[model samples]
Target: MTRTSLRGVIAAIVTPATPGLDPDAPRFLRHARQLLAEGADGLNVLGTTGEATSFSLDQRRGLMEAAAAGLPRDRLMVGTGAAATRDAVELTRHAGDCGFAGALVLPPFYYKGVGTEGILRYFDAIAEGSAASGIPLYLYNFPALSGVPYTEDLVSALVARFGGRIAGLKDSSGDIGYARRIAALPGGLDVFPSSEAVLDQARAGGPFAGCISATVNVSARHAAAALHGGDDAALQRATAIRALFDGKPLVPWLKQAVAARMGDPGYGPVLPPFVPPDPAAVATLVTELEKIDKAPARP
Candidate 1:
């Protein structure tokens, strides 16, 4: 096994908020620590699930600082990319300063149809601008939301140039084939598919380092089972929990699940342009999840 600190079931933790929508720093870290207790090997804070772009830089830094202060720094991966390159650099520097193990970086996403070289330069700028050494960086490949995809060529170039610092990738592109392709890249690139649903296959034919998943926020135990061993029953129940959000937005629904589990509704509130899951949808989600929870765990 590779001796990487970032490997294993990592939760893409959601930011908790006050009813007035303020970033609740204390509650946020509490929920993050709760995920670790639930079997998450690490925490990826300020991710898409966290609405990172919606929060200000201060809020973002606050989360990283809290995670550093509360948890083991080597178990933290911060999402540092921003619409502006400077913001990404600033955030990445903070991760380095905090001794975080890695950074999950989105491309400069405001403009669409960027050339391959342009996207490559964008990452190059982030790397150079970060001005910190030994801070592992993982490209956050999420074309659905960012209109940006990390091409194999670009990734290859990054690895060749930056090697250890350009540590891995998170393919939230939701395409297992694409993720597998990247995983198969030469030079031992660490690859994590967006979901734990693919863990069995990845484990069997593995280039997978592990998963960084919103689903792990609640399903950590089951997700961990899938990665540590091909526990088909655990994976089945984990996928069932994820499938409950078939038509709902994932971030809000994940927050709702966390709130329901923690008995703290504060986790359910999202930022502008996104709202909490409605009552009816929440009911269906909870019902299905509860059924899975009580089921026996065996392959």
Candidate 2:
């Protein structure tokens, strides 16, 4: 059955790359299965961490097509946002047609300082043009990368117009207050903070649906614990693990961490813009992460 609540730890897993640096479908399914086994309630595939934009539309769609072979479509939320409107719609439509749970979409990021009307028009165009006409569309908000913030007013306007299809907003702004404010907004919007830093607070009082976190790929246990009001210490440790990469590049570190965890060498290649760090750097990071991995599980 399709999961409708949207409350749970949804991991923005990294795209497992092949030796040729292509998106590997079998490897992705294996990663998804591992995350699920570790306690991820759902998988947010093709996300920022997954480097969705790095792959061609056909590659992304091919992965989507192959996902249901091993991953459950009802539990998959594919990142279908693109810098171009048509590209976004095409990917979003693919997610819908694949029978996945939701499509995480970002506003077109081509021209900085584009008006809110243009942003709304972009969303409107996708809603009107795609097979996502009936699917859940989770707006992806990452001002740091997209340079286009999904302001509260724009969110309300989009929801007001397309409430049926507007699933909710996934805020990667790393601003807890912004996430809480959106969570507290009226209507059926489900707010998901991108990081686990705000997880405890959001879980305790905010109207948060859950967290859509990149770290959850490795630290799902703590995130799941926080959601259930379990050990804060465990959650804090998980938060600290993420902080280890502070000031360092996040995506590459995460990819390296994955490689270390899986004992595979091929998981090192990131797309062009974000090249993989040297092996010595990766070895240093893996060594650092080993301490946490070897630590005792808190009750």
For every model shown, the clashing-pair count is 0, 0
Worst 10 residues of 2 by lDDT: 1-10
Between which residue pairs do clashes occur in model 1? none
Model 2: CA > 4 A from native: 1-5, 131-133, 202-205
Q: Highest lDDT among the candidates is held by which one?
A: 1
lDDT of 2 by residue, 115-151 (tens): 8789888988788776434778898999999998999
Per-candidate RMSD vs. true structure? 1.9, 2.2
What is the total number of backbone clashes in candidate 2?
Answer: 0
- lDDT string for model 1 (245-282, tens) is 76778888888888888888877888988866687878
Best by TM-score: 1
